[model samples]
Target: MNQTVRPERRVLAQRVTLAHGGGGKAMRDLIEDVFTSVFAPPGMEDQARLMDASLLEPGAELAFTTDSFVVSPMEFPGGDIGTISVCGTVNDLAVGGARPLWLSAAFIIEEGVEITTLRQIAASMQKSALEAGVRIVTGDTKVVGKGSGDGVFVTTAGIGVIPPGRRMLAESVRPGDIALVSGVLGDHGAAILAARGDMDLTSDIRSDCQPLNHLIEAVLTAVPDIRAARDATRGGLASALNEVAYAAGVGIEITEADLPLRQEVRGICEILGLDPLYLANEGTLVLFVPPDQAVSALAAMKSVPAGRGARVIGKAVTAHPGTVIMKTVLGGARIVDMLVGEQLPRIC
Candidate 1:
């Protein structure tokens, strides 16, 4: 007798569809097969139950932050939307003097996106969260029509604990304080532009996208007296420093030559009519410390791998309060104002 043969069952959907977002069996299967399978920790409550919310520790003050990622191309040289989604929120908390703890992620996926791509993004998020010493305890996913959404958009919310007596704020900065940067700037913005292949320009620039909580922790540990810290994100170092100056009622004077910039990034900015100081950076931070302690702070920061390129770029001053001025390389001074509008849009 001949035996009947059956076709093998496929484990993944070839493409996302309306049914995948309808909260039905298909949706559940997609979540289970793609997201939950990778995000849930071993012996945890699973992804669905994890979405209910996390329990906080007793007598803990929490730092909460939320950010959305809408970078074009989804993937970049050094990182992707998934990695930035986690790192952005984590850095937000860290700069606020918080020890990052748990995170919640939400996904808006467009129909017709490949399941394999979604899985890759989730895996990247998992890797980033692990590196930052945080847990992805909760998340939600929704699907949109093909034309209604980009391939994928991720929003991440993070919670962290602010250690006792550690208060880092823009308002805390004062005149005579020193300004320091963690590393080379504008790599993220330049890398994204090159990745788009819009200008047909090519260079070896890569995005400086990485979690900065570890680096921040090291600095805080060594110099708890640091007045302020801010990560250079959307508007880059220029905007971040302007915010500090305005909040603290002080002026900031930076030397053009002291600012860290990669040669390739400088060339890219020159070719693209961009300023490296105003370009976005994913893994860079600007710190304000008392001039007396600037040496110790810079040393502490340089001890960490992430801060090896750290430099004392400028100083907070009383002259021209609420403004930022740069001493140009050629014995000239220029006003570095806050960016009037978006230099680059849909970037983080």
Candidate 2:
């Protein structure tokens, strides 16, 4: 038995069992697995062969990316696969210091997928891509026989342009640099947990999923000398910070109390035995600045819409090379280790 689940809460309770991936009625049911029933833009119905690849943009550099959607519960409190596919690509380019220009989406649809559901998802992708000031230039579609693929996995490739003199690279970070985050953390992972019906507490800690190119633009325009910027996504802040530390060969010391985690998000972490410091944030950013330029950079970031909550979370210290230390809320300190194992697997 496929154990029927509510159309709106499809992905939860109904785990992607072996049969769901099997070609046949079971596979179709999974593809049409309606979670929150996303409503996208107009006329964005169905992926069809309008086709042949003569598509080429006139001018601009490209930053390509591709990711698989295996997020346990696709329809979380704030976002879904359709939007994540777009926003995720947008942030990758944004944090890389590029102005997102366009996107190419590829879909791997399993047998038995519903036309209506696919249309809804397409609308979502179209809406997000448009809002981020990027166009969906081209893409591909493929069907997998029963049991050969998951319901519907999407891969998005993007292209963007980086203006001259606005260079950003991890190697640019040096001694006496400061670290800043755009906003609160842990919202995304917590929201996914809640949406999965994890009855730890009564709450709706929606995912903080937002494209950050505009925010990045505001900062770079004001302070083009930025060392590096990164969006703390999948592996969470811990993973992102660690990568920066190793790449820059510098130590990052952050204050635990300085972290901007929503109270409800903090509460959920407690109930679920999770740590906000290592959790994921979709809309946030990690920026490195020369010590003398921290104040002005903070001001530039705070002036932006997505960066209203921006603050100086910490600074690079010469003592702890290649490591991140977070002062404990209890007035003590502990090393924020890189994720050795999946903290909240499938939460992405």
Number of backbone-clashing residue pairs for each candidate, in the order shown: 0, 5
lDDT of 2 by residue, 85-126 (tens): 888889999888777876777777666555555656677777
* Local distance difference test, candidate 2: 0.75
Question: Each prediction's Cα lDDT score?
Answer: 0.88, 0.75
**Candidate 2 lDDT score at position 140:** 53
True-vs-predicted CA distance for residue 274, candidate 2, Å: 1.1
Candidate 2 residue 156 C-alpha distance from true site, Å: 0.6
Give lDDT tens digits, candidate 1, residues 1-348.
998763332336689998999978788788777877788743324342332122354445668899999998789899889989999999999999888888888999999999888888999999999999998887888999989998999999988887667789999999899999999999999989888878888778888888899998898878989899999999999999999999999999999999999999899888878988889999998999998899989998899888999999999999999999999999999999998898987778
Cα deviation at 162, candidate 2, in Å, is 1.5
**Highest TM-score scorer:** 1
